[model samples]
Target: MSARLRPTSLPWSVYEHLAMVVGLVSLAVICLAWLPLALALRPVLRGDIGQRLGRLAIMRGFQLYLQVLRGLCACRFDIEAIDALRDQGPMVIAANHPSLLDAVLITSRLPNAVCVMKAEVMENPLFGAGARMAGYVRNDPPLHMVLECRSALRHGAQVLIFPESTRTPGYPANPVNPLSRTAAIIAARAGVPVQTLIVEFSSPYLGKGWPLHRAPRLPLHCRVRLGRRFDPPRDPRAFTTELEAHLRAELAGPKTS
Candidate 1:
């Protein structure tokens, strides 16, 4: 019985490793393929046309990548709730960052979404050019980030922000990190609502301390559900506190996958 089980388990293990490699390679190929086009469009097309095209391209690229993961990597994503926001007009999309792919999953569903990314990520060689073209705001020099996000909202682009500012640490033990006031401030200043998104993952793959090369449990699942939407705040500080409590309640209640 042990000898028979070994062969069966070995093949399953091999498949898991292969799937993980495929997922990573697919992401790299997509980014590399878009690099040159993003570079060319950055200087040549100035203003809305360039930014819109860049964002649309990114949305498509991410959509394709997710599809690849679904088909080839045996991953599952329940993100249809995100599509409802695509045509909802200018709004601040605030989500809990559980994993690195939080942005990717959300951005893949919204064509006009502009992300608020770390300054370093916005400057990375692999993602920087495309992000610049998409007019993604950098999360640094707080005032600058606020101004950029406001401008994007004014132009009818959905501003995607992670209130935690980074992935949650110690996860299940600490449902979420302390919320930042940036999203609330931006929404208030821009006169846009804050649409909260709750992203749940079956595994901690690509999470705060997860190793990049580690093979995640096969058939990993991710689900994004709509959460409470707060109107443009009259007082951002108060709103931040409310938002933080709301997230904690939602994330701590149950696991959905």
Candidate 2:
């Protein structure tokens, strides 16, 4: 059976597009504004302090953007065990990429985290500068990513990685993506565990291949449920298999929006 497609009302479509434009303009204003401050402090700020300033700025921007989304629609978020994950150190928080906002959501909340991002995001006008200043690791070679994550973990920072590598061809409403072993390899080397995060949404508004103009059900609801941490085994293959199995089971168990 084909998925029922609802016609988007013209008024709602206009509102969404307008809201997104306004929000993006505001974000650009914020990032551009901070660029000056960063340059001004270039002489006085060095290393960690400079990076902290950048992290703080980006974190605030992410939170502010989420608030904008909330104001535009009836959007709600349900997060569990996030606070618990914050306190833990040197752990890999394996996340499922269902929407474009997953990294923003995770990094914004876990401001101390080191995220593995694609090379393209590093060049993104809206996110690149902040990411570079925050000392985020680029998703280049898997080995390089692993080393960077390990170092961050040693420094008591949580590392966030999307095992799928990119947005899956089908998101949560479809079959799950294959789990990458980079995270497992890093965890095994660093002696940390991989914590799974399941992101469920009431609508696939920002899901894979979804256009920004596609308005989802009003008051879009998103939930994050934390799953058990897996200890990496001596055999990397075994660890990867276990990680995939665990995630498949948890993500398949229920739907939460």
Top lDDT hit: 1
Stretches off by above 4 angstroms in model 2 are 1-10, 38-44
True-structure Cα RMSD, model 2? 4.4
Error of 2 at 134 (Å): 1.1
Model 2: how far residue 2 lies from native, Å:
31
**Clash number for every model?**
0, 1
lDDT of 2: 0.73
Question: How much lDDT does each candidate structure score?
Answer: 0.91, 0.73
Alpha-carbon runs more than 4 Å astray in model 1 = 1-8
lDDT by residue (27-59, candidate 2, tens digit) is 677778776665566456767676667777777
Provide TM-scores for the models.
0.95, 0.86
